[model samples]
Target: MVDWSGGNDRGAVPKADAIWAGVARGETVEDPVYLRNRKIAEDWIGAFLEDELAAGRRVLAGFDFPFGYPTGFCAALTGQGDPLALWDWFAEQIDDAPDANNRFDLAGQINRDLVGGKGPFWANGLKRDVPGLPRRKDGYVNPFPERRLAEGQAKGAFTCWQMAGAGAVGSQVFMGLPVLSRLRRRFDAAVWPFEPLSAPIAIVEIWPSLTVGPAPSGTIKDAWQVAEIARQVAALSAETLTQILDVNAPEEGWIFGLGFERLLRGTPAPLRNDCFALPTGVHWTPVDEAMELLRSRLSPVTGQETVDTADALGRISAATSFARRANPPLPNTAVDGYGFAGGRPAGAQVLPLVQGRAAAGDAPGAVPAGQAIRVLTGAALPAGVDTVILQEDVTVRAGAIHFQGPIKAGANTRKAGEDVVAGAEILQAGRRMAAADLALLTATGVSQVRVRKRLKVGVLSTGDELVDAGQKAAPGQIFDANRPMLLAMIRQFGHVPIDLGRVGDDADALRARLDSAANKVDAIVTSGGASAGDEDHVSAVLDAAGAMALWRIAIKPGRPLALGMWQGVPVFGLPGNPVAAMVCTLIFARPALGLLAGADWEEPQGFDVPAAFDKRKKAGRREYLRARIRAGRAEVFASEGSGRISGLSWAEGLVELPEAAMQVSAGDVVRFIPFGSFGT
Candidate 1:
């Protein structure tokens, strides 16, 4: 992560307010490097992110300040719905020239444009009086909320609304977004929740207050604050980092430690030589990093067997497959026409039709000089055959066929191996064979194929309050929706689902159930009982057994995930809430199970569609709102609460909100993932 500054150059000395950068890789966080100017900072950040990414390491970067405005402010000011778009626009509007910048002038211009002459922005640090901008807060109406959501959450957090106050972050927002926009564009990095979570470089809006507490007497506050942040980030375990990345608030960005604020202890990670001490404070993990770590550690199912080509449809190939034979095994006719030989145009004038005709599977005798052979589509081309002409294009009279003028040579003639060559790779390993693949294989004379063994997955439903759907729910009990849903999804993905049924919140019972299923299944999946509650016993069991890393992902509707090994069999624990459980199963567990089942990583490709409604979200966390496309725009479910099971049921798919503070207007582009894309 890189610390940022928004102030102008601080003469040759880098002051506390000036931008200082610190990079933390594992346990070692380098000293805060001074960047005297914005230009130097921009170029340095770009180069650093690139260098880190190029080295094949994932970069979880954070910038100090609000990456976006509070809710609708960005969309209102710029007429752009996307948060990153606002960043780019803000960056382009600002003119930072090292020694001096137009921060006050830009503030005045923004105030004029947003609120006419009287404005919410106040306090001019500029020595000169700027028109429209105020010297201090007076009677001007504040168009935006007094503080961002995160600022409101954090006690003593500075107000970003003020332009010139002691704790004002107005300059930071104005100056910071421009550089961030440039960095994002230059690196093609993902700006948190706005983009898909696949990019190598991820930029986040960081608040130093998130990691720093009240300083002691005689301490340099700024230096100590920067050091504290570097230490905290350095101590971030893979699991903790994963959880942080999981919190994707694109529009209303979240503070890094919003949820984990209580978990933060000043266990600083020390700076050493090149090597870093084991990552400390490993309480949470980011969703993306957890997935990669899971994928890298999992070994694909080893069983392989041959299946008849008829059964190859929807089966993943275990090895690279090649064609048994070339398509059109021999030269054949492509149309119901006459087969023209060497005498082509000479015979075109008037050629004697061959007595023996070539129909499907029948070879006609070679045509002699000045002769034509009558052939039907798919009929084998006889010796000396060059082309086939459609019967409609030729007129047959008195046993002689006359063709149209200027028929190209070899027209409508299908050559052997034209479609597919023998011994050529047709299907790759780990490909879930489609119907088209089977049809192609059959056409190439393949009778059987080798495919990975189907995954035998055990599905369990945990929660004492969960009852099967067929049974009536008793008091305080809810229907077990996740189990059936997960089972159906597993089956739809071509894996055999082993139903473990509904297990109560008893940890011993859950552990016993897991032990029994260990040898019977390749992997185990449980829905519910993974979150932080008195009833959340699933994570407690895993933690006690030292079985897996529990995940507190930064996603709405689904945040709790437990992954571990039970008696050598990998197990995935989903959230207790039905909607969150389903989402976690689909997004994380599905890909993970596929990897274990010997399938390549299959991610649902999202389409960009306009939003049908206005959405306000903070930066630093990702929320997948249950939504559907209507009239070419994405409309989210009225409620995005995690426990709302009906939301997922109503949605055709999900509208992914990026990590940032944004107020999305109707017709704004949003990434949409359809249910059909997820096989289940």
Candidate 2:
């Protein structure tokens, strides 16, 4: 496996972003070889191949660059759709040296002379301006699609048009294809998906990121990726390797291990740490940064239970479920018709009637040649019969049936395993089962499933100024809305809600309530007194007991969050205000509780809708506004005040604005997340 680079050479010392190659033979893998430049890398690869071939070994070499552009690009460039011809064309046009190349010039020439447009390619990363190459995609237009079919299948892969930005692979395509073409010609190598994988040497396109994982300490990431992929690929069985290469991508080449990436996934990520602890230097975490920390540090805390499939609705699956039996389970007629050994007929045809009839749950029977038997819908097709003619399409006569000409085989027949195959994965782990899922599982003969036990989450409210609703309020006391709201929200999140009720601003009382709730529930949600204020008994009590750690998240409406553990139970201390408390729970606690309850940590699904209002947002903090989608556009609340409790009822969801300074005009697309998507 070769990690290709398109940049200038580095010095003799090994570094990242330089070309590196890893070789594997059987179960053994060699240390990655760092090549300083493209020319040197090509020479080194050629030498390695020659040595291997001379020793009578068949070699499969993989390079991390796109082997072809989008479907129509090669035809537009070379008057043909052959990717190999495009590779040769690139080899003819490009010039390479240790420090420089004509890749930018060739890209410009192709854009102007061949395709006759400004771009599909852009972002010339050169100091000097290159003709026909733009620095940004703001106004660029392309005659062809920006991505290939493989790019759509693999998430986060950049289009080949992006040449000079972070994660761009276009430069590598321009510089690497020529070398590949030359190597193919010199070694008579078969380029995968274009030609059969039957040769002494086979070359394939690869994207290393598909199988990348954490690198070991003191190991270069590029080197680790190449070495790991090489070892994994070399260890694949012949049948598995053949399956991985069996993709229909002749025009636009496929990534070598696109679908079979698990074979290359070196190791699983470790489980979450024992406590909610942030890194030492992290003071105020950005929204994305905080989420990444949580994703890497959190795992399931609940145990699994076996439940009947009929009782599995709204429960998280503990493991993936496979179909015990196919949905149809046998070849069956799709309608009330005659089953017969069907064949193509030029005109009308007639078949003699058989002695018996077939219906649902009938024993297996056979039909004589040129004979038809009466069959009903859901009836298994009798032996020696492969087709059925609909009753409406045929005429029943004396001991015979008549049908029209040009009748196709297998018409109106439901084949076995058509809807679902036995032993195939039917339900994934971490899925929250619903009514439809139960029906599917029952149909596939999955009687019971392993599911996670529901998490018991307790809700508590602090501060002396709050009183329960429906009670006569004293002076300066407001009704306690956070507890009821939080309790309901917890139930909506598919967990058992335990109301811990209210506690005053006394530290002793707060500690007692937390201790008692810790023994009763799996986790606690406290909505008031989470900060370091004089009346913040919750944080002070947990902190004095060495259980609290404050997280200053850089998000609007919700900034200070207190996370801690008491008696082995996690506590999420949200803001005292109602709006901030709700937002923080939806944004952070929902996914956190999901992880603790044995479900996958999932972000709320968001959609891009046009903005109905205009605003200017500043950097350094992410902001989410209470908003609703109306007529395909998202409109925020009239007020940004956190005290406006009515706005929560008025809006359907939240419009999330990113942490960047930009002017959002009316009709600009903005990301909107519905409250229902977060299960609230």
Candidate 3:
């Protein structure tokens, strides 16, 4: 349990009543920790969570602040039923500075709109009077007539709407919600009532007053309350704890150990069975299983195309190619010299010149025994000739050619089928014709080649806040980074990329755009709107169409993949984060697209190398960390946040951790995949 605060730093010495933290693990309950400032507290909490998670321990942290405001307050402020939407809404509206904040002023503005006068929240402690703020409560009105159920149930609990008085929790609500949102983002955790309970790390609300009595002697009440709450919550059985969580309302989150007030009173609690308070583990699709499933469901379309050898570069071969005829069907002279029938001793190199010269493409008639023929390079030699002496080393004296160098049989002569035999298999089917390969094919007497037709793939980006790069960006707007990026990736993968442009969050616009693309392209790839959110409409649009599949895979920087068919054309939906979109496109979509285009499945190759740093990972998920091989050691980025585009830029490759792989120490061997393997 953590005692949260809204004020600035408590310098030098930690305040006796400021921020405090407590922990209970196994049968041991630790003392409450003191945090003098917000920055220190945040740092300490982040570090502690990382340590516990890295050690393969489950952490369920409790914060002593309201997770939700009064009833009807959220619906009146933001049109959303789920309390998480409100957390995100507050996260967006509030601007937090470490030293200070505008909580009082923001509360005043909310009061002006909700109450139409000084009200609901009216007390101010600031030196300057903000607009719509009442310095003192004289005729203040309350917009919300009732306190929240959780607050009402907990006796002596302060109202969330009150601003600046003793026991007032208004500032904590203004400040804590945003901090909680950021904390949830920083770790692989879940916020109570806002996110799923499957995560090992849980951030839940706690009201000590609801379960704690006065402090023991020689200890502060703030710290004692924290210790008691953590101890009591940890001691409850899983069956009992889960019942409380499941029965709690989603809009109004429940306090921990709410009904077990007297079970562990005034004493240390005991450990229970291994049953978890929430879901025990994560279940994700294996990489190979997913690949085979896609391959089995999709039909391979490989239309044939006949093209000249010059136009066949980078095209997949449709059929095996064989040599039409042997290279140099007859024996030929490899040099411009005198061709002799003398396979005699090494000293017998003198021969008389013949009457006719054997120029290139000329087949001189059979030479009589003991006779010699003068032949040019590439000219077919006479039947009786087996050796040739270079003209540069021979002299034409009188009527004979002479050489001083030693002569061997078959010297300077090319035999039949020396380079390629007739009807020999040269190029195999499904081979991507490279420049050298194309040249070699032509040399083997190939003129026209058959290849598979290039696939037309459409790339699309969806989000209400996204716009074209060249267009001016307004507030809360970003350029369409995913479409252009994925388009480049698709083109680089040897398929044609068709730009489907950007569509907003509206499902109708997305449906029309996808339909149009389905008519023009064989496959479509979209990024964003693949997660479970109200703004996610791509899945809904595809659902209306004939076939649509959505999946949740356990991989970092990659969300669930959405696969379906639109008018016989395959569609791939990637995550909205630019880095995640790129990773998914390469790891999963690239292979799936290759299968659809009738290309062979190629697994990426990786090397086992030592790690440069230590890492703690979840057991049940396959994770890829952006890293670079530095001095033969795989080093990952300091920050793993997907939004940092520079992480992708700095990474030369990825360090892959397999499912069931856990903590890794420096110098531990890990599999590393280079980016070149993906053809990036």
Candidate 4:
């Protein structure tokens, strides 16, 4: 562990707030070393790593400063969203020495020329002013978020913008990153999460405060912190180390041990297994009624697990997720222009400009009376600033801004809590987390959440004339297509799929397969032998198990739907034909699996569109024809046969014909359901 410093060299004697390094090996930890300056520390670290690598030993070195800036700040600086690129850029620009360095000047140049100026880096501790650098935190504007995702989770952590005040870390980052960039090039070292975790030399960003305790009397706090943190990290189990390294922050590098605290606390709760027994006595049921029955009777059977927000997509929220902090955390500008406090003006007006501009992520400053300050988009609005005028509407002449007004008092100003308020629920329980949801959750300071465990749904195909795919089939046998199709569907619906390979038609074999699947998966979906024939073993086995319900649904291409429980696990028995099986799975099993996986019970919505073909049918049973939209009209496949598997691939969606069928003309409007509505 390295406790880095950005100040000038501390001569001869060892002291606190200076550079310190602690090394730990198996069953041994060496005394901390104090390096007087950056040049000395860099030389020592490089030599130490080289010797360790020569001895064929792996070394994990850590530094205490931030590895990268906030998300957009890197892209704005390097023209790419890469932290290493920014590191290289800093290495090329910054010139460091033992006593005097150009860090403040570089920061000023970055603020003024590189990015639209004002401030992102501030607190220039020099006696005289540098061009674009500010003497106080409130003087500069930031063009990015104030903190990274990792920083948001780390309470009491200082933002990497304060350069030379108490708890300031900005100066250290500006100095340390350049050294790391050079060392990585010298020794091809992997930085965690950005580059995969690997052998010879690896550098990680760490915060010793997370694990350090009170220092021993008379010992330097920085030295004690580095020693203890290094020892702790070196002693971690391989599994724990891998978990800590398995993060997804490339641009904004993650802090070591930030989200893995709970993992070391305890094991997770066991999964729940409540048998979902379907109701009996349903003969020739309508599609709507069947759906309602499933929704009312089924509930989630999976337990919950807490995961980092970076890995939470597609998981179902276990509880309502609330914002930890208000979004727009501070009131900010909505456009690039000038901000000033005053009521709407009548016509043309001119005001003196403030010395500096304001950008996003910078501390909010106060605007003087009758004065305007240049503000970039997302920049925090200065105090006394209630409105902003677009740059196109203004002209700069004689050190003053001139613009025609009558603009609203709060125009182009986004208020704090404008998007989300702190403690307000952002996602409700049973909602499937999406990409956009992650953005909202992170921006509001939500780092981790409890999500339902993915449900493992097994697919089993049974028939005497069946063979697995990729094998030469015998006479009178065909490759099993239902298993692969159903497995993909299970994954598409956000559930885990377990393949329970083909089983021949036999009562004992079918029973054994069902019994094995009950222990391995949360639910089983078997295609074939669903009807009550002498050879139909799926329904026969369910009947023998004493929890079977065969629903004769009033739908074409699908009718015999068998629902049952086998050894405490639910089972959905579908028809053998591929086309019929797919239709039934979408209509009945998709929503059921979603509910079992802890998501809301969703019904696929359909809309009416013009029909391109004309047909007449009797009014007894509902029908769904495999169709696609052509010229804004529904055009169905040539074949309506259940055995036409090619039709399933050819059609984009299904056109529904109601129970009271009265279709006659080609111009008639028909209800069409897209495959995407079923999450395909």
Candidate 5:
């Protein structure tokens, strides 16, 4: 446990005897002094408990001095023996305090014994033992050293008394001092002396033998391994030590009580001390090694061919420009109207006899004078007609039309080639097809188009402990998930997914599969068999068949990935874990596939969002945590464990944490990448 004292003056540390004596005699100090002392005592006790919690201890019982005394003493004097009953009474007293400061001090004091040293007084883990005491003993006693509390009296009363009996309680208050008396019982059980409580100290048990094995005497291979071990130790210590300090430490020593139990449980012993140090000079050649091995294998060659446009709707394709013109050239009326000769009819009142009706697509003919032709919308106009009068403007009377106003020439009439002229450029080259493009092409009477072919991606899964989805799992086998996921992802990228199925852990089997896939597909993807496990055969197979490239990216959940080429086709080997495999595929494989497919892809869209809670992380590593957006703020899923598949399932997006920051506070702005950005 990592516990420490909080106040500047030693007197802030509670003396069980003084508290018990005051309670027993019914002698209360002035409200100001009482409030100040209680605060100091509570602060010390809370710190001690927090340290224990950090060390990973479960507290069974806890005790506080004067804060718990009044109720416990009153109960004892009244013939009550139940500890819980005494605690309840003490809680009521603290809650009933007049002001917030007093209430907090009392709450801190009472909580020291109730909630395992956690309450209002000392942050999240510390428990206050008194709500009415000063925050610091020295601060209360000496407002200013230059101006004494009294002309002759020593101004350092609080500090002097605190240091003198820092860990001991006076004999006068022995009976009523619940915290000290309880601590005495605990020490007796541990075989530590209960006397000499004035040592201004706390006693913590070091259980290195139980929590962690003896310190390692040999060297380790990597820094990560050492750091991992340290992390485990720290987690264990926090749980164990928290409880011990909260329940068993003496009031006076409460501020100083903190310790951890380190037990080593595996074959290799754990490193000792509070931290682990790993060697820093180790060098790696992952990329070079992968490439060297791949270069030795021969690649298969194949001829490329083109596919028709209709079949390439959902596939990647090369684009080309096309020029075309509309058929059936002729001038026609754009709207329903009557065709007349010249600009307008002279002498508007004069009546013209009705002639033949000219509808759309009708053969063109000459227009006679004193004759009006009834024309419908889109109809071809007669050779001599230059103007059209809309049907709405003319009224029929006695089988003849009577016009109220003159009609303008060429009004409501469509000219030849108005929309698209002959041999016009309809579309440019290298453009992807859209709904509008299809309509325009059909309208131009074009029947065919040129486009590029879609790239085919082959997906393979390799592992001895893997089984197909339909099969039942054996004792140690798990179902393969990477292949299906990769296939779906490939499809989403507008590429063909060529499933190679599952291969055994054998290197020859994997190599044969890769060899066959390389000949048929433009790219290959494999999951698992990338790590340096005893049975890992991906690297070995790649080396035997083609050139490979590996990257040690500075990102979490996808660190162990291999990018290489098999017979000129790119091969991406993702980590076995579902989360890591998915992340690596998006970061590396997706972009490569886009390049091959002739799509101009850009980085995923991200927005700034406020974090909903505090988050702790290590520096120097970029972390992407699955999160959800609520009210424009990013909230992380409750379970963030890498192995918890449910965590991903519950997340609607991802939060990108940069490498420079080690911790994230509530309301801090973070970059949020919605799941839609990944095509999910």
Candidate 6:
């Protein structure tokens, strides 16, 4: 056994040396020396014990020397017995002892004396109080005082009692119990009453087991390689330990039987549980089961009703070719120029004898030959004027205007109805208002235009376990998160959200709310109360009110979802889980609302990226895993729990696992749906 107190000089002590020399030579020493050696060995042994136990080793068997006495009495037997038979006779004297502590104290004292005292044998180079020692001012005294100690007393004192017996009893008892039980079960009475135990027989059975194969018999780069090997060994050992400790272990026959039972339950049958095997047959769904209950209830059985698109915008125009009513109805100049009669001579100078200045919307009389009218941009053209020469091309001399350049026919002229004919179609029906559209409509003399009415969506939430945010939750209640998340989703899709508040688990209340909302809004959207659970009444209400349809999609975190209509009003019932509700609303409800509102429906955008780590998944279900995209790679977040909303906040995107995949390997191609794309 290795001495753990080497730094403290316990191994260098004469008594400890003698015991170690004896053990090295395969000889047993006296009780005092042997006990002292074992005590020193214990410190090294304890550190290894935890590792050994976790590695599936029965450490207690090696530590407990005398079989059943908590702390082995082998050293005590060695005094009057052959060293080889020390452990053999230990059990006989063990019954005479009062308690385990007594044996522990005996062992502790042996170690204390070997390593203690300020004698010449103290190899630790420290002083300790002995039977007769000069007392220092600090209460401790050195029996064999050093030259340095006399010069100046050391600040701290050392004591042997503090090291011995500190944790010996606990260590001995803890290590002994499991080993003794295993030995008793294996060798029975032969290993018990360990008195008269033969040294050769004990060595043959135990020495090889405790040796640890000479430190793995090889060199390692550093502690890390050794640690990794130890970790693997520990993992394997833990599995074995679990098997040994397990009570009521499962039987192979019973396992097969349970599996067979599940197989029968999963198989569709009249062939199920039949003694003779029958050919597989397709099971026909009942007519009622074949039909979608929710969809059928909400289906519009009647033909198309006279639904009118009426709101603030004006009525639709009947004529396909409608003309623009002239804005400022008159002939107006498009540029500042002189309005004069035709047949003016080339480069001819004219007097500025202004006939009259014509401003926009002003009426002026006709201009005769040799006379020019001053016209500002957008000013009405004077009567009988065929053209206007720009000011830059004419010069004013005295009271007359002189032509600086030759004026051409129809110069600076804006032809009537150039922008739009008086009777041209400005805007068609169903056009939504934009700034440019408004300007065009006003130009066409349209005060109001026809546009599609915005769809009003009624929203509600149902669950008895829900409470409003910032309110104290009662037993079994959780603060409502789905409602707020759903509301945000609705508003993001550009539809008006009319919150109908929340309803409890009661079916009647849900029915009343649904009926009222259906009458007022174009569509109804709700969260929760859509599962097959006892409290799920939304489906039942939909059935009672009208036709409806529900679909159990092959998607993770959102399998249970319903999409239907009530009295021609589309209805969507989302699951209660906050994450599930949010994801489903974004994928299905948002697009549906966009379609109903006459807006273009676009799929949520996602990017292809490499998965940062392995992802385990069930086959046949599409999974949307929350992940963080960093450095252009997708990394999965810690919380994958479908019910945890914080996961959504922590995630930068969602990694979509396809339906057919059972697992995603690291660096595999994955679709990373950025949260920003979904209006996060």
Against the unseen true structure, what C-alpha lDDT does each candidate score? 0.76, 0.86, 0.77, 0.85, 0.51, 0.49
Residue runs of model 1 more than 4 Å from their true location after superposition? 1-284, 343-348, 363-365
Best by TM-score: 4
Candidate 5 Cα misplacement greater than 4 A, ranges = 1-311, 326-432, 531-535, 543-546, 602-624, 627-636, 647-680
Please, what's the RMSD in Å of model 3? 35.0
lDDT of 4 by residue, 426-448 (tens): 99889999999999989988776
Best prediction by lDDT: 2
lDDT of 4: 0.85
Query: What are the per-model C-alpha RMSD values against the true structure?
Result: 26.8, 23.4, 35.0, 21.3, 32.2, 38.3
lDDT by residue (tens digit), candidate 1, 304-398: 55567797877878666667689978889899988867434433467788787889978546777667888989998888787888889889999
70 Cα displacement, candidate 3 (Å): 86
Kindly indicate the candidate among 1 and 4 with the higher TM-score.
Answer: 4
The digit string of per-residue lDDT tens for model 5 on 1-680 reads: 11112222224433312211111001111111121232344444455446645675533222221212222233432256443334344333432211122333443443354433332122211254344233333323211122112112322212111211343111112222333334434333121112232322333322111232233233121221222222233323445444534433221122112232212121112212111111244223232232333332222111112233344354332333333555325678877877777566555543464567788778887777756678888778887666787788787777567776656677777777676664565654334456666666555554444343566889999998899999989999988877888899888877789999989899878878888887888778899887666776886665545444345556776666665656566677888888778776765567556655554442578999899968988865577887998887889877655566777778887888876657799899999988777765
lDDT of 5: 0.51
Angstrom error at residue 519, model 1? 1.9
lDDT of 6 by residue, 421-508 (tens): 6656655432333456555656656543322345678888899888899999999999888777777766765556788889999998
| TM-score preference between candidates 3 and 6, better one | 3
**Rank ordering of all candidates by TM-score, starting from the highest:** 4, 2, 1, 3, 5, 6
Please say which candidate is ahead in lDDT: 2 or 5.
2
Q: What are the per-residue Cα lDDT tens digits for candidate 2 across 1-680?
A: 99999888877999999999988776445668999899889899999999999999999899999999987899988998888999999999999888888988788777777545478888888989888787787578798888999999999888999889898899999999999999999999999989998999999988878976567567798998897688678867888898998899989999988987765542222332246677789888998877776666667666555567888999998767878789889999999988888765878888989887999999769998889999998999999889988888889889899878677889889899999998878888898898999999999887767677788999999989999888999999999988988999999999999999999989888888888887788888998888889988777877887767788999988898988878777888999989999999999999988887778887899999999999998887899899998899999999888778888999999999988887999999999999999998
What local lDDT does model 2 show for residue 577? 89
Of candidates 3 and 1, the better by lDDT: 3
TM-score of 3: 0.53
Q: Estimate each model's TM-score.
A: 0.58, 0.60, 0.53, 0.61, 0.45, 0.41
